[model samples]
Target: EWQLALELLQRMPELGATADVISYNAAISACEKAGQWQMAVALLARMPKVGLNPNVISYNAAICACERGLQWESVLDLTRQMSAARVAMNTATHTAALMTFSSAGRWQEALSLGPGGSPRAADLGRSCGTLLMECEQRDLLAVEVSLTDRLSAAAREGRELPADLALVLDLSARLRRREQQPQELQGLFQALRRPRPQGGGRTWASLPYQRELQLLRHVLTEAPAGSAAAAAAAVDDFGAELGEAGSWAKFAGGSKAATLLAAVRGARLGDRVLEIGTYCGNSALRLAAALPGVRVTTLELDPLLVAIARSLLAFAGLAASVDVWTGPSKLLLPRLRPLRFSAIFVDRWGSQYDEDLALIQEHELLQQAGGVLVADNVLTTAAASFLWQVAHPPSNSFEGAFTSRMLAVREVAQSSEEDWMSVSVANFQADVFRQAPPIPPELLALQAASERLRERVIRSEAARLEKGAFTEHAKATLSGAGIAPLE
Candidate 1:
């Protein structure tokens, strides 16, 4: 249908046929939905040539296309032109501009729009949710994650967004990528309105905070003079503490992790953070710095690296907190009884992530309501293995009540050749089982079976070897021949 409209548009222009506003609007809308930002822009530019002055509708369509392209700057420029043309700002236009700036974490620009002393926060949650969906579809999420920052701001402002906002945002973004014939954004939004856990709980609602979350964390601990919002007002104070660092872009986790972490902290209160694989505290520093006053309990099995992290933390003066747990998570998580974290970040040094997550969940560490569990290396293997356990009769070794709320999961943008990196975030809302008694099966029986088989095969091979009297047979044969092959 859209293609037909565009064809009509092209033909009318070539054949000297009269083209009306209806045809132009239909064609422009089609181009916008096609993810054809360039074509949409080009067409809009030619509107004056066709003696049809671009109206608010045309400007809005171009802005929508620019937004999809993540060319928010272009969106801003078009938005200004709309005002210059004396076009009244509608809710959609204001919302689009607000969303663009919010997605970039440019809070100053986002907040400066409305007049009056008291400013109304546009539904930034809608944009946050929308941008996150874009992150998922584009396969390029490692770098852009400012949604959490906006999320925190919305929560603090007491903005009561529709329960189904995330769904609406996701579907709106998807309208470009794929077709959902019977179901459109309306149905999708309705589905998301179903109740769920609130994010940024003292105990997490879902997953890990990236490395640069320290920015938002810092505001939580202490606010500078003349601040309208303090860190305390920034997010739910889930007993989170803050740590600081100097540089994040130079960290081992890459600037993308730092950028996303900072966004999460800035947007929400992220505390009681956990780092599963703290490699010399490079990424740890980024998270510690963004969070205003949240102590991060980082886990690393290697002793040398643990020492290195400690030294780095001390140098950053964050050693007063940011405790380093120097052992396997399986051993440490259980002992820290009565545990509930706002976020659990996993970056285990090796690729045994499947087993490692199983071990962590088996301990029921973040098994409280509104806990977030984020695992790295999932873009390489981001699919949640324990999702089935949470959903049904429970799988081997995993015991939890929750559903995965994926936020962002993908590889770090290309840094150099010969290196690969990725991360996946899953939010979990914990529940208690009222079904048949919780199963007491092995944590990793599926893996255990293979070990047992390997052991059996090794033992059988040894027994077969022992039973063979090769020496005797060789001696007998040599005696019959009165000669030995080697002797």
Candidate 2:
């Protein structure tokens, strides 16, 4: 239908017909209906060049297109143009702008719109609910509670809250009261957290990993400030009081601490927060403390670690504030849609960082504007590939969407050994950043082939081990035969 409408407009030119503002508006609307945001923008831009003046409706159509594409910066830019052209702003204009802010996770800005254009309390509540439902800050929750109170009072007096806002607040209150879980919201949580099949589990941390995390946390806290040498020596002191550091993910080290602090400091109260690697819930605790009543969701790959993290969180009286789920983030992130995060702390295995980020884009998980991505251990060689992707995003895509900064720190337990690390903070900005291009067919085929080969290798090893030939000699024999051993 939209295509036919567009074609009709184009055919008008062949019939010696001139397009008025209505024709352009109709064409733009057609493009919007077809989800052709770029075409809609192009048509709007072409209007003036063709000697037609763009009215408020023209600007609204373009802004709506940008909003559909989640091109928040473009939406804001067109709105500014509308003001410069002296076009009177209307309810539709304000609604479109607010919706853009909401989609991009610019909640603070959304809430700060000027007078004569502010949304109703119920409308504001709906947006706030979207922004703050998963957020931990009490103040934000208090705001919602207050709004709900007002709405309830209004209802008692025969006035009613908007249905959308009422539903959101109801669900939020239920979740807070332990009457519900996010995973229960099938549409929201994406999938159920089922038990993964038991296989030869991979062990990531040894004593060294634990010690490194502990040492890093210790140095960050007790290390003498302003003295590099003292900081170095504190790295050497493994027996220092564990304090708060002892409770965090043992392997996060100092960079993660810095990243968490940076993220929490930059995050507004009640902003939804995500931690990629919970390990033992150390950073999760810190995040909760940093912003009281702030909701924190942490993902761990191992179910065993998930149990441990939950136990620790319970012991710390933080179980209610931090929701720890078991499963790889790549798999779980897709399920966390319609619940965009305000900040994401990446402390997962360094090698998986790139793939994890790709999943984020695939899922549209991050809040588009002012959202932060804080990654730990950016200095490690293993992290180089991930670092490159963020620092040098593909041309015209995610290139200017994030402004990144790298902070230098030391490896956790390997502090005395001078194992340095880095924290990368990438803030989402209101700029044009294209989505990641699709995976090439060749790469997909290669990945499939690799998976098949890996499965074959695992099967052969399982058969060999099942035959009771699990001795060192058998291992050496497999190695000599170029067979991969199971970890």
Candidate 3:
């Protein structure tokens, strides 16, 4: 169908009818739906040559194509081109661009765009929540406050807020309140609730992760401490509660937990172990409890989850054995100083597994000779690229042949869904770091442009804040002198 569409457009001139913008748009849309991103982009580029100016619909189709292909840089480029051509972007354009940026973890760029005119609540909430989480994780308090204020104003103007945004805002407010009252552990309960905008039928309390943290807190508070047996018992109790509440699928328990624990126990790890995902600290708790001597360093990108994991770890008496680092694995991996771990567990984004492994090797975070790398949810996450790379290691990337196995496990107890965990051991004869592939010239240019745009946004925000403060001060001074301030 896509081929026929493209052919029809190309033959328009031969058939004595010139291709118009609408014809080109139809071809691009066909290609986009068919997953032919390159063809779609080529058609878009050919528009100018054929004397047809690309409009919002043409650009949106191309952007959608690039987004579907995960061509984040392309999406950025298309949006920039739209701006240069003075094509006013609609909500669809903004939504596609925001999705691409969010998928690529470019939260700053996504936040810079903000909620465009007449945006869908679901799309806007997801983008805002992701950006806010990034800010929280990076300790960007100013940016977080600014974003929440913008969202609050939007809500006041009758914009609907989705459940995700409401949940994140509640958590953000609670965290701020908790920081003010460090001595009060129950500050979240006592903090004055903000008037929530009504739209989504869900509340923060109904969130599964929050419920999991609460259950863990209650169970650990009641259970005895100071030993691995007690911690394991607490985890079991927590799992049982989740099952009763029909939320066990969210937790990494049952067969998945058993397989991960088995991999760790069989790894013969040394004094250090690294975990990439620390959701509720379930796996970290299990690893610490299993090997009391091995110190565990876990990385979690979500600040809320990091706080919950830390709380659960402390309550389970394993806080001393595990250190939870709050940030994405990509940013945190390079910062881990000279501390090589004998075993590394990866349970984060499956698409980043290969890239993170390369980072681990480059930074020498994993012991070269006998390091064990265990990756969870490989099959379900469609991590075929990672599996193939580890199985067929390039000579330059790895020192020696690597041995690995894929173990299938049930995602949840008595559930039909199955997942796989890959456990691999290194057999390096010498220390070597895999050299990262060079970025394409086009991508480098796009990166430079994105950086410039980000700086411009920052400068614009500073000017706006400065102007607002000056206006407020002027009004106060005029009022004190018995003169009405200028409207």
Candidate 4:
């Protein structure tokens, strides 16, 4: 059909005529839609040869064609060419990058575009397993190790490590020890390794915890097992029932939301703590379970959410040390004494993530002496914007590399299944806003500068990796490493 379209074009229009943009676009689309991608690319070469020029729309259409064809290298080339010619990369260009990324199963790339919302780290770990399998099939060890590091980082930072990730870890260890075993032999090694259990059903029994467990059951029931009173507790509004342990439910599995939850049966932390978001009491329950040895005071913006979290706490049987209040921080924060907090986790109004961070800092609630603050979804612009605004010469990143890694994360022109859909398709539905980042002139420049430096460093590292010289010492990067552990 593409051949027919091209042949009929000149024949119908006087056998010899300069192609107009519309005529070119029509042929391009016809070739793209017909799956004749190489023909479409060949037709593009005709533009320069025939004295016809490519416009922004022409470049966009051509990129879209290359993108849809899964002609990745071609897509990248045309994209760069458009840039060299100063063609504007409107929303269409950016969107195509996302779409193309998805097609190739390059999920990280897909998720990084203009890029709001990251998948829960656990989901990324799951994808790492799938990618590892694909790499094994293709016998691509270099790509496999790179993907494994990404998986390991996500898992170490609280993404659930699936069996495959564990295998990757074991294999990575073996490879480091100079044993690059065959792919077909992975199962034997896996079977020899003791299986890791899912700590999904964490049991707790302190006074506050039991009651809150009961309340949580009422709110979200069909309890797992072995907790009768917990499974039997009431689920209606918590404030209404003075006896109810807790209420409210948020249906996130740390899958899409990028917030992973571990039901710690026995965990310990300092007495004074602050949390930024309280959707239901999912995190609150886990917090309460950790509080037998300490006190935890959390803040929330919604009374409904507060009530729900409160019930979960009451049901779980620990409500005294936990305070679930609903209101803006401006009003509530002033009430707390300065220098009163030991830890704070930020996970609220993404738009105001920066503001709340400042509040936490200025009020001295978080002392510089080992007061930990874990900010969620910093991968997104909404959170990054706030972070960038609040920066001094030094930034509040996890490490020196955050600014760059966040920006040049190798985005593509598509979203593929092993792609964008893999890490965060669901979260994207809830987040879905990618207009220009809310950047002021100064901060925008700062962000651009940070990204530029980051890109340069990454390029140098990639060069090293390519030269077969990228190596880690026998000790893990974990020991006083630049990256922090989630727990």
Residues 1-487 of candidate 3 have per-residue lDDT tens digits of: 9999988987988999978999999999999999999998999999998788999999999999987888888988898899899897776677677767766768677767765654554344433545555565567777776665665444334334323333334434444434524344333322212333344455545433445445455544556544556655666666666555554334566677787777777775789999998877878988888887899999876554665666556546676789776555666787675888889999864545777887887787877777888888664443444555454433454443356776767655235455567787877644443332343343333334334433554354435344334334433432332223123
Tens digit of per-residue lDDT, candidate 4, span 1-487: 7777787666756866656777877887788767777877777777777678777677666767777677766776776777678765665555565456545656455433322124454344323333343343345667666655665554334224332233334434344333544552335333423433323332233111234333443444434222323422322233235313222122222222222222112112356667667656555555545446656666665332344455445435555557665444643565465535555656553345656755654565653444445454333212334444332222344221111111111111111101010011101111232222345554444334334434554344334232112112101211122222223
* Model 3 residue 304 distance off true place after TM-score fit, in angstroms: 6.9
Q: Decide which is better by TM-score, 1 or 3.
A: 3
Q: What is the C-alpha RMSD of each candidate to the true structure, in Å?
A: 25.2, 18.7, 18.3, 22.2
Model 4, C-alpha of 398: deviation from truth (Å): 15
Each candidate structure's TM-score, on Cα atoms with residue i matched to residue i, is 0.33, 0.40, 0.57, 0.33
Cα deviation in Å at residue 154, candidate 1? Answer: 54
Error of 4 at 363 (Å): 1.1
Best by TM-score: 3
Residue range with the least summed lDDT across 10 consecutive positions in model 4: 417-426
Model 3 alpha-carbon drift over 4 Å, by segment? 1-8, 12-121, 124-139, 145-183, 189-248, 265-272, 277-281, 285-340, 348-365, 379-385, 388-401, 406-412, 415-420, 429-487
Q: Quick one: ranking by TM-score, best first?
A: 3, 2, 4, 1
If both were scored by lDDT, which would come out higher, candidate 1 or candidate 4? 1
Model 1 C-alpha lDDT per residue in residues 1-487, reported as the tens digit of each score: 5677678887996888888766677787888888787878788788878788787788777777776676767776776777777776555556566556545545455545532122233334333333333333344333123343344344333334322233322432343233444345335433433433444342221222222233232332344322323322322121122212221121234434653474345332445777777755655666676675877878765332443455344434455468665444544555454555566666752224545566555555553545555544322221223322333333465543543322232222223211112222333433443232332232233223334433554354434232124223322432242222122
Give all candidates' CA lDDT scores.
0.47, 0.54, 0.65, 0.45
lDDT of 3: 0.65
